[model samples]
Target: MTLIHPAEDLGVLRFITAGSVDDGKSTLIGRLLYDSKAVLSDQLSALARAKHKRTAGEDIDLALLTDGLEAEREQGITIDVAYRYFATAKRKFIIADTPGHEQYTRNMVTGASTAHAAIILIDATRVSEVDGRTELLAQTKRHSAIVKLLALPHVIVAINKMDLVDYSEARFDAIRAAYLALAQRLGLQSVRFVPVSALKGDNIVTASERMPWYQDEPLLDVLESLPVGEVSGSAAELRFPVQLVARQDGSHADDFRGYMGRVEAGAISVGQALRVLPAGHRATVAEIIGPRGELAHAHAGQCVTVRLAEDVDISRGDILVAAEATVEPARKLSADLCWFDHEPLSSQRKYILKQTTANVFARVGSVDSVLDVGTLSHGQHKGTLEMNDIGAVQISLQKALVCDTYEQHPATGAFVLIDEATHHTVAAGMIRAFTA
Candidate 1:
């Protein structure tokens, strides 16, 4: 009964759960936390005494654990992204229980942006068999398409509520086959399927005894075994965005200047040559400073202060990269966007496009195409992108931005568009490629 401490040298796996409304996403998460011994006794007591229990006969409604808002509890729906952390002997997990309703698609995008994997739930009872063909829900298709767009490393399709279906292997197989076709059309890889009853706590943390016909590992085991981080591509390339410039002037000889930020993509070591962009100033790493002390090197995810061998005109919006790396600065780019605002996107309106530490004034040059989530096809844009719409569009920036394709490096490729007038974030975007 040993659990790994979150800070005890275990790799952290960030994942999100998505499905149609009432597909048992919250229940599945609660079961994982409760059965894995991660929930505290006091929390369990609170759950037992919860007045909004959805289950009958005094049975605890596990879904209540994540539906935190009173309105959500009363409505039996998740409104915002609910994050939960738990650690097993093998790895630490950060699970984001995202809302399943179509309107909350933006919240799902937020949860999936940084996730290493995505668990898409399928309600066994929701799958309708018509004319010997199964039809998946629209939300399910939308979420899966998003997971594909984000390029998540792994996708686990959990066919939940098996108890409601008599733990039927046929139901699981049918749903799996149906999802597989969708996955193929979306070009999704690294997908795994599991059958579980989130309410009955079957095949979540452990193998289900009733589903003896199923031979695959349980949901928890599959999650623990999956490889984390960038499994391939330019993940090894160094891409650090300078967040701040630390300066101290005691004397000319004692002048201290350090560029501070998190190493977003690869690794950096002392003596490594770096190119500052879009200024493109070249310098050698003089030192790497952490809060504790100076370090010889820093890797991705570590926040540190870097002193270059020579003083360069580096600023907050500047990016530092391996000098030999192939990167370009562009003033125009194409991107995939998930619009989140009630006001539809206007090509003429200006936005503050923020990527990492860089912020630049930009406008949607054109609305290339909008996705039809149900049919999984793209159609010509109708001049405006409405709330919860996903589309490919071109943006013109006032300043050149140094970036990579989202498929190449997610940390550097992701950005958010803020309404210039309201200052509220209007959309989340991933750069497809630089057009100019």
Candidate 2:
């Protein structure tokens, strides 16, 4: 397989596909790869073999292409995020096909976190059918809200299984209206509704002739045209978290030491003044170093080492920021957390909080509320947060942390909660506020 470097191609777009069970998310992705001619011959042969093993007269199970795990195959459901890569002439794509079951909501969040766009699939036949037993509509609304909260720029609503509804425009319109209402409520800005039949490959790579009422671009066209570069531009505040301290000793010449890290936000230039946070010390950038040589400027997403003229106390977890930018350092934080582990999160329970290469001891200070996804309500909870549950919690860190709200800077505002005993990540959290 050829490796396509993301930096070399600025048109690479990372997106996630999410929906409730049987919405044809897996099949839609399979069709995309197949229609785009990204699937290999050997992989196609394997798929054919898997098809022959299935019961006769059944459609080729496209879900087989992504359900790689033994457990997933046996259960016939995607359990984790399955990453797939493809490229068109216009753009290269990396897609995270996440599970749709309620139990795997955390997996969906993980897949959607880094995605610039999201494709939400909905079965057309089930558009208006109310399911009070399962609260299907409520679940869909919750998924939409979470995706919006992550600040995804574009959302494509794929009304799949159009063939099952006999290509009814009314059905498609009804589903589109429901989604639009929910999107408006959640403050989503960009949304596109597409009617598709993944089984027959309609309105996927090419527009479907059966649906004459719809005139928008095909799904692939939308994917190819969406902007993939930096969304906020260079106006945001400069943020660089120290990842490693590099020191080189030269016997014949001079000794050099620098702080190395990826620029998490904004831009920086040589000789620009900066401040070391948590320590509140000031320094000047003596040199901006890269792989080739010194650089005059650096922007978000670039990995570089910076040498300061005056060496102040600097270490991993310390943040270097533009001197004029204001930052707050605190020991207590309020966060929106998505529990991922099987074990429940309890108040006063200690865990390791990892943020931008720094790990600190932390304890759950308070459990504010647990989100009831089905009711779209916040339930007052004082106990444990189970798997796939979203809740608000207060954490007390062992040391002061330099941070920003998740909306301001994702790198400094996000963290993983690690189990102290097993060293396993239990939850992912977005810092909402800090208490002085």
How many residue pairs collide in each prediction? Answer: 0, 0
Q: Distance from true position, residue 403, model 1, in Å?
A: 0.7
Q: How high is each candidate's TM-score?
A: 0.96, 0.91
What is model 2's C-alpha RMSD?
A: 3.1
Displacement of the residue 265 alpha carbon in candidate 1, Å: 1.4
Residue-by-residue lDDT tens digits, candidate 2, 124-207: 876555662212355576678678667788999999999988999988877887777667766798899999998788999999
Best by lDDT: 1
Any idea how many clashes model 1 has? 0
lDDT tens digits, residues 219-284, model 1?
A: 999989888763322423889899999998847888999989998888889999888889888999
Q: Which candidate is the best by TM-score?
A: 1
Off by over 4 Å in 2: 1-10, 51-60, 131-139, 231-236, 250-253
Each model's lDDT: 0.90, 0.83
Worst 10 residues of 1 by lDDT: 227-236
Scored by Cα lDDT, where does model 2 land?
0.83
**Where is model 2 poorest over a 10-residue stretch in terms of lDDT?**
51-60
TM-score of 2: 0.91
Residue pairs whose backbone atoms clash in candidate 1: none
